[model samples]
Target: MSTQQFAGANDRFLRRYEYDDSWIVAADLGVADDAVDVDVVGTTAIVVVDTGDGVAETEFELPGTDADVAVQNGVLTITVAK
Candidate 1:
């Protein structure tokens, strides 16, 4: 999944990336390429930014108000708060 928008004058360039969770993981070993990290902390739900690092530290969690969700450096982090 990806999206693009042109805020510049002529949109001389293209900005695109992929976004999907069909088969994803979440976690971190250290500072990721994007400089942030996020994980569900208990299960296997994790969201990464730009590390090319792989899903070894990620966890899983349901998305809801009780989801201790957070973001750092560009990654979405989910924790067990409820």
Candidate 2:
């Protein structure tokens, strides 16, 4: 038998992202690898970024079955394709 337990992995923050052509744009999170994390939760993509002052979280709704997450030029980008 397997026991199911919650890992307490709840979304600490919620935010919205700007939608572009086949992509979602998140806020600029400055530069710090330790302060940034991207995760795919079910059908939504989550981005967490901390800048010493506070943490910024952004979520993008995926439109398709696949998603690709990346950070470039201090910005978080999520690409979704159908």
Best by lDDT: 2
Stretches of candidate 2 off by over 4 Å are 1-27, 31-34
Instruction: Tell me the deviation in Å of residue 73 in model 1.
Output: 9.4
How far residue 38's Cα lies from its native spot in candidate 2, in Å, is 0.9
Error of 1 at 5 (Å): 42
lDDT, candidates in the order shown:
0.39, 0.57
lDDT by residue (tens digit), candidate 1, 1-82: 5444233233322232324532222232234445545554444455544446543342333433334555554444343332
Give every collision pair in model 1.
26-46, 26-58, 27-57, 27-58, 43-60, 44-59, 44-60, 45-59, 45-60
- Show the colliding residue pairs in model 2: none
Candidate 2 lDDT over 1-82, as tens digits, reads 1121222234232233434445443444556656779998777777777778778676655656477777776665565653
Overall local distance difference test of candidate 1: 0.39
Count of steric clashes across candidates, in order: 9, 0
**All candidates: CA RMSD in angstroms?**
12.3, 11.0
